[model samples]
Target: MEKIVIIGGGFAGLNLVKRLDPEKYRISLVDRNNFHCFPPLFYQIASSGLVSANICFPFRREIKKMKNVSYHMGHVKQIDIAAKKVTTSYETLEYDRLIIAAGSTNNYFGMENLAEETFGIKTVAEAAHTRDEILDRLERGAICHDPERRRRLLTFLVVGGGPSGVEIAGAIGEMKKYILSKEYPELKPDDVTVTLIEAAPQLLGAMKKKSRDRAVKDLESLMVNVRLNTGLKSYENKYVTFADGHKEYYETLIWTAGVKGEPIPGLPPETIGRGNRIIVDEYNRVKGYEDSIMAVGDIALMQCEAYPNGHPQMAQPAIQQARNLAKNLNKGEFRHKFEYLDKGSMATIGKNRAVADLKGFSFSGFFAWLTWLFIHLISILGMRNKLSVMVNWFWNYLFYSTSLRLLLRPTRFPLRKHWGD
Candidate 1:
């Protein structure tokens, strides 16, 4: 049996393992974390809409049934292409074939200070921290008599018009309307402000124009302040300065603006392309490489006529590419080139409101919202997760409440027994 090594247990990598026959290949899956997190529903975690365990699936449990599949939780430090070896924190791995599926990271675009000052929701840990900060700020703001500090703590600003930003902003808006109204009556509905600032003229720039308009309308209905044509110039503690000389104050700025490929070291510079992705051929094999090495998911830039640059860094393209490559590998010859099928895109804006562009036909409102819910429920990894999410959604809908609004703080920040008495 040939030995195969795959790095980064993301959507692309996990699916690749599923397609491969363990008996035919000795597979080793490596990742920094032991579990795989669903990225699409990360906003719900950040807004206390869903728990972390509801979206996480352990790879150990997943690969236990496979006889030849092994899981290693280690940080991959380098990939030696010439030697066909991978160096990690625990040990080194030599393989007959290698697949690099390492995903992208938050791209600050040379804004070092902005990256430090803002919050992001790219991972489960990041989403948990965002939730913690939100709960902490709300608790502190409720007791503060100082108007300036209270207002600053209550104001939530999100930078980006993309799906992550839109979803998070909408979740926060709904959180304030439903959760805060019942739990923290001391804080009025007008006390919390959810503002979404985008540099583009409209939101959801990737979706159709009609869907974009519907999203804007839906967001407006939720009382979310949509700021368009606004660019971020600088950010400091509790203050954001815009390009137009306007300044805003907020305790946290959820930066969902952009991301770039997370390429490993020890690879030649020529193998890298725009957006830090590794350029690959039609069969998802790295350029200039024969067939020993391949790249897939967000890190692979496979250019074609329809997508001259590359396909979108999305779940569908990544999953499809992984499955395609696995099929060709199983055939022992490069028989199929990857072709993307755009299944359509959708984004939810609060309860019973969403916009979807399905095969160029645009729709919004209740029907779109139902479609969004159904699709996401089926996309989740395990049955337990789907059921947990569904139960939470139903409970929330019934009483307009979410029970997972707990502030988890570090031990260093110990609470006083009697309000610092």
Candidate 2:
């Protein structure tokens, strides 16, 4: 049997493995994280709607039933194409065929100073840190008597008007209205401000024109300040300078602005393209490698007719690409090229409002929210995770209060300040 080694146990790698029959090959999957996180609802976790553990599913337990499959937990440093071996932190391994599903990272767009000032919502760790950071600022605001400084600390700026940005802004809006109102009776709902900024002229740039128009209107109705075709030109600490020569101080800055593929060492610079994606041919073969190496998911820049530049680096595209490649790899027939199956995209603004663009149909409001919740719940990894999340949502819906709001504090104000507020 042939040996297959995959790097990055994200949606792409795990889904690919599911499509492959274990008896046909020996497979080893590697990732820096031991658990698989559901990416769609990461905003809920960040906004305190869900706990970190609730969204995480251990990879080993989930994949344990497969006989021929194995798992490794580590960061892959380089690929030695000449020897057909991959060098990771623990050990070096060889494979008859390789899949580079190694994921993406937050892109700063070469603005080093600004990158230091902003945070990206990409990983479970980052998401949790962001949640703690927001709550920490609120605690400080509660005691400070300076009204102007308090307003600044309470003001939240969300950069990048994409789905993550939209969702985060909406969630924060809900937090300001419902969660904050219930928790801090001293602070009025009007004291907390949530702003959404995007360099593009509209939000959800890839969606239909009407959908984008409706999203902006819905967000405004939700009291989320939407600023389009605008962004931070530079930032230092809490002060951000925008392109319009306006500088503002904000305590909480949620950066969902940009992303670039995580750079893999040892691949020639020529193989990399814009956004650091590994340029792959129509068949998803990494450029300059005939059959020994391939890439999928966010790491691969697959060029095709429907997606002349490359398909959207979303979960559905990744899952479809992985399955297509797995089918060809299990057999000797490697003739088919990977094609994306367009499953419509959706975004939720608040409790009962959302926008969805299905293949030929577009829906919004209550039905769209239902679609969003059902799809996300079904996509969650394990049964316990699903049940825990469902219960939390149920309780929140009825009571308008999050179950776990107590600060897991370090107990000393000085120590908390040292951690950087």
Maximum-lDDT candidate: 1
Poorest stretch of ten by lDDT in candidate 2: 412-421
Give each model's whole-structure lDDT: 0.88, 0.83
lDDT of 2 by residue, 1-421 (tens): 8888999888899987787778888898988888888887888877888998888888899789987888887788788888998888777888988988987888877786655676557988777777877787778788878888788889899999889999989888887877776787768777778899999998998888888888888888767899998977877778878989999887778899888888888899989987899998867788898587888998888777777767787888788878888888777668887768788889988788789999998888888998888898888988999999989988887887886664554345444432230
Model 1: per-residue Cα lDDT over 200-292, one tens digit each: 998998898888988887777777899999988888767788989888787788999988898588878998998899899989998888579
Show pairs that collide, candidate 2. Answer: none
- Candidate 1 weakest ten by summed lDDT: 412-421
Model 2 steric clash total: 0
TM-score for every candidate vs. truth? Answer: 0.95, 0.95
- Using TM-score as the measure, which candidate wins? 1
